[model samples]
Target: MSESLATDTAKPLNGRLAPPRTARVVGLGHRLPDRVVPNGPIAERIGVDADWIVRRTGIRERRYAAPDERTSELATAAARRALQDARLKPADIDLVLVATMTPDELTPNTAPLVAEALGIGAGAYDVGSACTGWLAALSIGASQIETGRADAVLVIGAEILSRVIDPGDKRTAMIFGDGAGAVVLSADGEGSIGPIVLASDGGMGDAIIASHEDRIIHMDGHTTFNKAVKVLVESTQQACERAGVTLDDIDLFVYHQANGRILRSVGEKLELGDERVADYVAETGNTSAASLPLTLSLLREDGRLRPGQRLVLAAVGAGFTWGAGVVEWGLK
Candidate 1:
């Protein structure tokens, strides 16, 4: 009946079901290529004004690819930064998980190629779940550490959507960007890791999806906006409940940076204050699975998140998929 009990009600659901384990984050980093495409230039291409875009989506600028950059380049840069933060060499990694909708090469999978580039050997592969890709990767890494299958896992969210965007259509050209973010997941025995909840409804798969069939971002903006807000709120509540923390108890909350309006809707649902959530949609635009981690990198740079802080990672996109997880930050 009380708010505190209601706040963490979902955590016990996962706790009574799964055995205890230990997990923690050791490092974090991100990278974006050196191209800034502002709304005014995009408006000229799409026959819309900067004012119209701002009024509708609240995006000012987004990064794009250089003539030479690709998805692999972005991911590798972010991964290197993450490894540097951890103060370890590439060979120290036991596993690498790349969360991406756009793979550099369709055959061997992007992970192995990334491993080869970063010199991590054959202990790498790829995971695809559209915008929810990173959260899915985080969940998989958590399980590996909890079960002792891996001592350290490199989780990355990277995208080079500009290459796939239809330059002729301003609708998408204005909405997408290119970037990557990485984090090292491991165990600390202090219960730094907690419950995670993931959900899906394939029927809305078209709402915000890009197909490799034609390799284009096809989105029903209104539908995607509505669904993202609803699902993220549900998962956020579920994650908080499972983590034994109330929304108010969380030090910071991070969500997929699709749009400023969408972020506001989710914030309203959880009664979260502006200080609790960070917004980068204005700068990075929507980098698919890369959005949240990139936002985390920016926040951490300014010294926002710290030990003993509860973090909520939430996202909804493509495959009509959605997920939320609560990670307790306290790594030495």
Candidate 2:
């Protein structure tokens, strides 16, 4: 995808503007916990059969961190792998942004802990937008890079939902997993990340929330499905329009790995066939903030994502937050 095809607004607002610096994803990696909890165990605990989980959620298994494993641990591991993948040292990072809903602690933020573990002497912070964390962080990272605030940034989405979920609550227990995914974003002359469309609806916030006492996730499946499908489809189309490209031009679609049903509905609304969408929910379940980046890492590992291809990434999160963006894949 050529930058010239982007809307004029993608360029500088005034004629005397400097040439925009492109922020490109240089590396990607993800880490899932070692313990794989199959549907059978979860089903048994929830008074259902293994087949029921697959039929309802399309989830066969999910990874759970050990008792001692924290969100920072998963994040640091992923950041290390991303640095290795980018062939850059931690010292090269100018900033670190972590997107996570579940942090090991309430204060101090998980990003700083991850940065400290990785020996990154840079600004670090956390972004909390539930499942849309990665996309939101990616947008912020791109802005920082493009505006010359930071030349290199590590954006990570990590979560340990297992710690917060009520194991007895079948709706939440069978859906979430623990994992982290990271991407190294750097300034590039030719590569581009743009047309990031973001929106939020605080009105539907209650559709998904954590219990006040236990912080356990409580969700209204029916309501979430309708809102997610509507927002995701709208954001995706807006992203493509802003990028001055058609949906047909997108080589791959990476929607939030929230639910299999939501993914299917979004694809159908976009008229994108199953082949174009990336499906990782069956294996990873809902890794919350880590979903998008995790899916990207899996696609890279499987050789499905190639350099120079146009990609569209969309997501809808618990805050009623949602977004989509267009990217020209540059990693090799």
Candidate 3:
């Protein structure tokens, strides 16, 4: 159950601190509760329709947490899978980072529980940056490795929005789901962690927050969307520059899965086109922090992502948080 695993991708790259020849993405995994909430059923239950939900948010279906499933448990499940995929034991992990606003207890920290379950005895903590949680974790994890404080880190985005999603609120119930996705990041002892950019606009936090109603989700979609587009474009540009790459030179884009409209808006502003941005809201709904990393893993499995492609990983979510990262696929 060690944390560091035998990876098919980890290999000796270029200079240690300089431009890394590569940073292999060792493992990837995800977990979703057993309950399936089809669009029609959800719509019927909410007095809405399939077309109605799709037209508004592009969410066709989503998964809900089992009544007994805790947020930490779901995260642990995903971490175990990722460890297995990387052929790593829990003890091998040097750090553990959990991204969630729907934490199990909000104390003792979800990261420690996940590490305890995985057998990793490294620094552990939870990040509560709303939808931007996972992407922020990626940046933080990369930094730890880049600085040598930790060579390997487990970054997970897990959510059980049902804990806060008002089932009666047709606007949100149709758009949120429960799921978790995790990845293993290591330093460039063999590769490098490049230009990563993260930004925040606390002013917009009120646009899509779940506070007043005991922290239940309450969002202003139009306002949130407008800000998302602008932040996404700016983040992408800044990260690309830091990575020493041009915007036009980038290949694929993995963005937070909130809405198809949001994705289209970013692409239009940046001229990235349909091939550039990967949006999964149509299939998975808005999984909050888990959306971007989940899609990245899927792309890897489907062979839709080729090695050496410059990837822009970005997110804009609650707290009005946003960030962009430039990653050249770490491959053999």
Per-candidate TM-score against the hidden true structure: 0.92, 0.95, 0.89
Q: Candidate 1 residues 227-288, lDDT tens each?
A: 88999999999888776667777778899998888898889887889889878889889998
Evaluate all candidate structures by whole-model CA lDDT and list the values in order: 0.81, 0.88, 0.78
What tens digits encode model 3's per-residue C-alpha lDDT throughout 156-250? Answer: 99998877877778768888888999988764322234556787878777788766448789888778888888989899888876665677777
> Which scores greater on TM-score, model 2 or model 3?
2
User: What lDDT is reached at residue 279 by model 2?
Assistant: 93
What lDDT score goes with residue 221 in model 3?
Answer: 77
Predicted candidate 3, C-alpha RMSD: 5.4
Query: How well is each residue in 112-222 modelled by candidate 2, as lDDT tens digits?
Result: 999999998899999999998899999999889877899899999999998888888877789999899999999853346866889999999999998657678999988
Order the candidates by TM-score, highest first — what do you get? 2, 1, 3
Candidate 2 or 1, higher lDDT: 2
Q: Residue 33 of model 2: what lDDT?
A: 94
Displacement of residue 164 (Cα, Å) in model 2 is 1.2
Model 2 TM-score is: 0.95
Q: Which candidate is the best by lDDT?
A: 2
